[model samples]
Target: MYTPRTPRIVAARRLQRRKDRDQSGRFLAEGPQAVREALAAGVVLELFGTGSALDRYPELVAQAPEVSPVTDDALNALAETVHPQGLVAVCEQVDVPIGKALVKQPRLVAVVAEIRDPGNAGTVLRTADAAGADAVIFAGDAVDPYNGKCVRASAGSLFHVDVVRSPLTIIDLLQDSGLQVLATSGAGEDDVDSLLDGGLLDRPTAWLFGSEAHGLPEAMLAAADRRVRVPIYGAAESLNLAAAAAVCLYASARAQR
Candidate 1:
């Protein structure tokens, strides 16, 4: 069993930092769900689990070629959550280029533009996967999709979709692929439901979501085919990035299905 202070454990812990993750071209996937997904994605380099966790999930252990049993304390030190799920894995980064992702001719794509919050970014990725989005583009200065909190928030869906990081050029790339890029904005001129009712959502679409603090920038809004607002019938000022993305992506998913 690797001790918490062992060199391998210390090295894995460094993955929690963006610089370290970038330097190593690797990141940590903590908990059973995230680790399982990482393993299934065929990106896991090493799998570490507590003895109990290894016994509890024999299926995972059987599938993993490089498995190590660790003490509970060692597992806790490696985990990011308050309650560690006793399993974690070191995995390679899987994000591909925007052009490669576009080659799939995705029916639905989620474009996250400058979303700073890791949780929000992760939630959006998870929601996008659930909505059957073929790819997720992290455009502008968006947070790293491999950030530990983001990975945790994604609940394993991170491995289920193509995640790409690009600049504002992502918008042009998405549009050039024959997709109608719609920016979700509070001041949007078009209503989401109205567009859906009008059959606009049935087209190959990409939904642009902005940061939590400020919505989409003016340039982004202008670049989009149209700006859409998720109707606020409840009198709540506006939906958060995750909620807005869920509504928009699901609308497109249902429309296309």
Candidate 2:
């Protein structure tokens, strides 16, 4: 069994960092679900699992291209979780070019702009996938989608959707996509339900979600076809990013279908 000191094990540990992952064009997917999805997506290059884990997931092991039996210490070194799940897989980065992601003329899309929290970003990705969004764009200093926390929070949805990391060309690309851009903000003129009632959500649309602390950039909000706010029914001050995104995405999903 491979130990923590093994050369390959040591190398796999570096994938925990974004810099190394970007340089190598690979990231670590931990737990059975993430690994299984990565395998199904044909992105898993190598899988590392403890003896018990391998036995527990024979079907997944059978599908992996390369499997390494590892000690608990080795698995722990590659995993980000406090309680390691005994499995981790090195998978290829799944992001595509912004132009390519928008080429299909998607009716519904989610643009995650400058969201610092990986968990929130991943949850948005999962929500998008659940709502049947065509693609998710990480634009303008957004959290890396390959972040371990983000990967885990995605719950295997990362491999199911077209993801794009576009630092600069998002606005230009969105304009070219022929989809109306809508920015979610607190001080928007239109409420989400109002948009739905007005039949605006039926159009091909891309929703722009910004940082949790600051909301969307002024430029993005200005460029959007409309600024939308999710109405607050309860006494809560505001909805968190993931919750707000779910509300907006599902609204579009309900309208479009």
Candidate 3:
């Protein structure tokens, strides 16, 4: 078994940093679920686990293109979670160009902009996949989709959808896609029900979501074809970024189908 100080182990540990991840074009996915998904996606570059972990997940280990047996200490060094799962996989980055992501003529897309939280970003990605969105675009200043927390939060959905880390502005990209852009906001002209009732949601659409604290930028909101709000029937103040995204994406999903 490889020790924590092993050369390969040391190199894998560096992936914990975004700079290393970006430079290497790879990231770590921990636990069996992520390992399984990464394997299915054919993105796994190397799989590392304790002997017990490898034995427990015989199929995954067998399927991996490359495998390394590591000491518990090495596993600990690689994992980001408080309670480290026995397995971690180094997987190539799955993000694609904006044009390729939208090449399928996506009917439903999720545009994530300026969301700094990795967990929320991953949840939104997971929700978008669940809602059958064709693609997800991480626009200006959004959390990196490959961040370990985001990858974990996605619960393997990161491998299930087309992900785009765009260099162009959200407005420019949205305009080029020809999909109606709907910005989710507390202050908005249209509510989910109104859009549904009016058949506006039937069109190919992209839902734009912003940060939990600040919401969408003024410029993005103005650029959107419509600003939409999710109506709260009860006395709750508001939903968090993930919850709101789930609501909006599903609404569009239902309408388009």
Candidate 2 TM-score, C-alpha based:
0.98
- After TM-score superposition, what is the CA distance of residue 114 in candidate 1 from its true location, in Å? 0.8
Better of 1 and 2 by lDDT: 2
TM per candidate comes to 0.97, 0.98, 0.98
Which stretches of candidate 2 lie above 4 Å from their native place? none
Model 3: CA > 4 A from native: none
Q: Which candidate tops lDDT? A: 2
In model 1, the Cα lDDT at residue 130 comes to 95
Cα RMSD to the true fold for all candidates:
1.0, 0.9, 1.0
Q: Could you give candidate 2's per-residue lDDT for residues 6-28 as a string of tens digits? A: 99999989988889998999999
List the lowest-lDDT window of 10 residues for candidate 2.
Answer: 167-176
**lDDT string, candidate 3, 1-257, tens digits:** 89999999999999989999999999999999999999999999999999999989999999999999999999999999999879999999999888787778889899898889999999999999999998888988888898999999999999999999974266766667779999999989899999988888988899999998999988889989999999999999999999999989988888988
Error of 3 at 238 (Å): 1.0
Candidate 3: lDDT of 111? Answer: 88
lDDT for model 2 comes to 0.92
Poorest stretch of ten by lDDT in candidate 3? 166-175
| Candidate 3 residue-wise lDDT at 54 | 93
